[model samples]
Target: MDVEKVFCMNGGLGENSYTQNSYLQKKGSDMVKHITLKSLEEAYVSTTPESLGIADLGCSSGQNTLSTIREMVEAIDKTTYKFSNITPPEYRVYLNDLPTNDFNAVFKILPDFYKELNTERHLWSQKLKSSIYIAGYPGTFYGRLFPDKCLHFIYSSYSLHWLSRIPPGLYDKEGHSINKGSFYISKSSSLQVSKAYLDQFQEDFSLFLQSRSKELQSGGRMVLILLGRRDRTHVDRGNSFLWELLSRSFATLVSKGEVEQEKVDEYDAHFYAPSKNELEHEVKKEGSFEMERFEMFEIEHYSGPYMSHGTAVARTIRAIQESMISQHFGEEILDNLFENYGNLIDEEMGIEEIKPTSFISVLKKL
Candidate 1:
């Protein structure tokens, strides 16, 4: 499905804007530490690699990899220290993301990892005892992101909902589907669009679980963190406030002749929010792993205070498209969307901060 081109549509996590942006970095740093701590606790209970093979799927390229790897190495160290008699094994860690990502960022970090390894070796007889082998790969996760049973541990964050691509049937010469059966297609009411995204997510996630089941060792583990919705009712999918805002906003766009009526009616995904139940349902369908832990919590996503609602609106949209602002929305359309967001946010009921709930789930392969 030309995943390379589609996945490459966005600059990947390496885009200089957010890839290196301070806001995401700070959040990710904390998130990875928490993730590894949990994964390690689980791994300690079940599996000890005579040699360990770990992977960070959709890892992107940057300091984030270091956080996970460091935690992994530490966990192994602590475990070996407690066991004393068992020799710590060689470690092979594969860092992965889409093909178009900046591998250079990963390569640049490797020398530093090894240099520290060598330095530590001399200071203490078995310091940083494991032999570390790090490599990078570019591939779509939907279809065998790695080799069969090749990984002992896997981790991914903030990347699962992105479908390999927007669904083909939904996009026409103008845009994508708006209303199908019970789906909403308005700019502010993009339930149909969000549903499309959810469908694609289910498809992709199911495939991910199936692939991991094949690629993960019998006792391997996986952890994923993603934005999710709180509502579990069938009707709630249609009632998401974010979707409603987007639908109404787009409806305004169509009414004012600012955006194509058909275009607004056709496509969805102004914002994608999925419920935990939906995610759990898909993962269970894969039948490859036992769910060890699932936690959902709300985090205030602040773009910071802006001078005015319009400025805030601009900042908000820019955050999403900073890397490929021109590709997804042409200059004029993007400008219009921002204006709409500003106007909408300033309205009495509009939200200044997006408080989406994100979830972290951990699983152990049987």
Candidate 2:
């Protein structure tokens, strides 16, 4: 698949758009918001740069992207107050995603976001602050996007689990698709299938660091929150069991001749969750950044203040994956497929079930 062409969050504020369905991602970011604020705090205090340049890698179109920048800017204000009791520095924020991302949707909402941000700053600062410039950088994060030392702080959440591309060896010796029967690594997948994913992640992540190293100033901080496996055994280990049920739903469609079994077998998600060791190994291998903090935490399949209804989880996943899936499978069956997925997933959520966890890594450019 040409991920650069088809990969993107569902755009606009519609029901299926990521803007409306990204509660779990927002929750995870909220969980670590303080940590992110602290890193932003340190980015200013540690360097005292003339201007603050912040980048959100894989920053899809939504409030989630702007909200994160709002928090970072607020932190810069707070940290500046504590340090010098003076005006905040000039601000430059970069929102980056793939070339195919819905940048127009993001741009449409910028006026509102900027107004809200300045309103908050004016109330506290007692005077107008300098313009908080926002720019949309359309490109893949797999390579360098900015000049050397261009960014002082960076943040990415609910991304990074997406490999740059599908793994190389899904087709076995028979070349008929060794991983044909599964969407991702399952109990039945051969060892080769598992290693192919691990190797791809290691290569992609290492290159990710190398590219970022060129853009980040010395002492710049980065916080990356991504899906990851708790088990030290393999790369494709944790998915909140969301995929298993989705795959099961496909089997139901296959039984009714609504979908082809071979099509299901031929598809594997462009996703992988690495173990902590794997993450550490790649970072160290890349030789650009040093880990300051590494942690793993769990998030519910569906999370919010109110009791989440049955469809929230399914809607969220569908918003993110439906575009890619429709490109491979026909678009006609998505409604039925996710309906079945939601039913089974809702039925299967246990009160005490161990949900898939996210790996939070805080790094500093060396």
Highest-lDDT candidate: 2
- Worst 10-residue lDDT window for candidate 2 reads 232-241
lDDT of 2: 0.84
lDDT of 1 by residue, 1-366 (tens): 244453332233542333443344346436546665767655654666677878877776566667667767766766666666667767888878887776776687689888886576546555455678888877887778777877788878766755676555444456435453222333443444446666777777788888889988887788877666777533332224444455556666667787666554444442345687887788788788988888876543435563564344344345444334344334566656656655665562353444446678888899
**Strongest candidate by TM-score:** 2
Candidate 2, residues 1-366, lDDT tens digits: the string is: 888889888888897898998888998888888888888888778888778899999899888888888878877787777755556788999999998788898899899998888999999976447779999998888888999898999899988999888887776667567776678887777898888888888888888999989999999999999998887654332483677778898999999999989898878888888889899988888888999988888765565565443478788889999889999997999899988887876677643343777988999999
Backbone Cα, N, C clashes tallied per candidate: 17, 1
lDDT of each: 0.62, 0.84
TM-score of each: 0.76, 0.95
